[model samples]
Target: MSVAAADPDFATRLNAFDLAALVYEDGIAIDRLMVDFARGLAEAGRRVGGIAQLPPGPATEPGQVDLIDLMTGDIRPLKQRLGPGAASCTLDGSALAAASTGIRRAVAAQVDLVVISKFSKQEIAGGGFRAEFAAAVEAGLPVLTSVKRSQIGGWLAFTGGLGTLLDGRMDILVDWWAETERRRAKTRHRHVS
Candidate 1:
């Protein structure tokens, strides 16, 4: 079911836009939706770039999350334990920097789409993939990301109310990708000509 269905203007917003946020409440499997969306696009021969977050596997450490690079199929650990004496954040800074490089490559290649896992607390604080997001937007790359409901304000502010808000559903993502891809193709053709 599409959460955006409740909003009458969602369909109008979905068209003619490249930047989007798949917003979800806490405990929703937003990452799964993101991975599935990116994977489906890649399978359809689209050049998808950026990283999607995955839950830690059985062999992964207790607090370790994973990020799968869409362009390279690489799975890297995204989070680490900061230990009992440390504060709450567990994001692996170096790992995120590595992921940012992938996004940069995607923008350079003008990939069909770029998927950043989420714009949460890190991005809200002007860190995380914020720079990568800015780069993609500047290059006119279609960028999709997941965002928690609590962080909607930050996502809106960052995108300057120019992004479409998608629900946590595969169908919505599929539709959005189709429209964005068509729009991007037209834009690219114009630039080429």
Candidate 2:
């Protein structure tokens, strides 16, 4: 609001241009939002330190990581709040490889609950419904999209809450990926030694 209006330049960016009008004129759906979220994450690579809030699961020890990466917010605290089927892993099999690989794998594996708090509503706005919806329908899983639109700016005029309502059920493969990644890392370390 008022802050943007105070800045004539911002006013032009919003009203003088058609960006704001287009988003409001046309209501937003779910699919498009997912696509946009993915794109942003790619662009934001290595920046979002990832929320280390670790959703509950079998207790596992932490690992040695690059001091720089940890300091740079490249590694956020693990996410908390585990569901009946939730699990967490360091995404490292051994002491070497980074954690992101395992995280991605887990997401693709179809676990009941994948807790990736890195995404927002706008990112997926451009993504179509059928593609994302199909996954949920097929797996019978639910998607709990989390976002913080309160302080966001620019052409992304989002409408709705931080989360989305996806019909049908689905699964998150987080546990599988975590297990695989940990195993791989350990195997690699043993081979090296």
Indicate which candidate wins on lDDT.
1
**Which digits, one per residue and each the tens of the lDDT, describe model 1 over residues 1-193?**
1213334564354442778889899788888888887888889898999989985456877667889888998887887777777877777788888899888988888888888889888787877788888777766677899888888987876665667889989988888877876776786699899
Model 1: ten consecutive residues of lowest lDDT:
1-10
Cα lDDT tens digits for candidate 2, 6-116: 344543322111111111112333223332333343365512221122222345333322211221235433323344464775423331123343333333554333223
lDDT at residue 24 of model 2 (Cα atoms): 17
- lDDT (Cα) of model 2: 0.30
Taken over the whole model, the C-alpha lDDT of each candidate is 0.79, 0.30
Model 2 lDDT at residue 136? 27
**RMSD after CA superposition, every candidate:** 6.6, 19.1
Error of 2 at 36 (Å): 28
TM-score of 2: 0.23
User: What is residue 94's positional error in candidate 1, in angstroms?
Assistant: 1.9
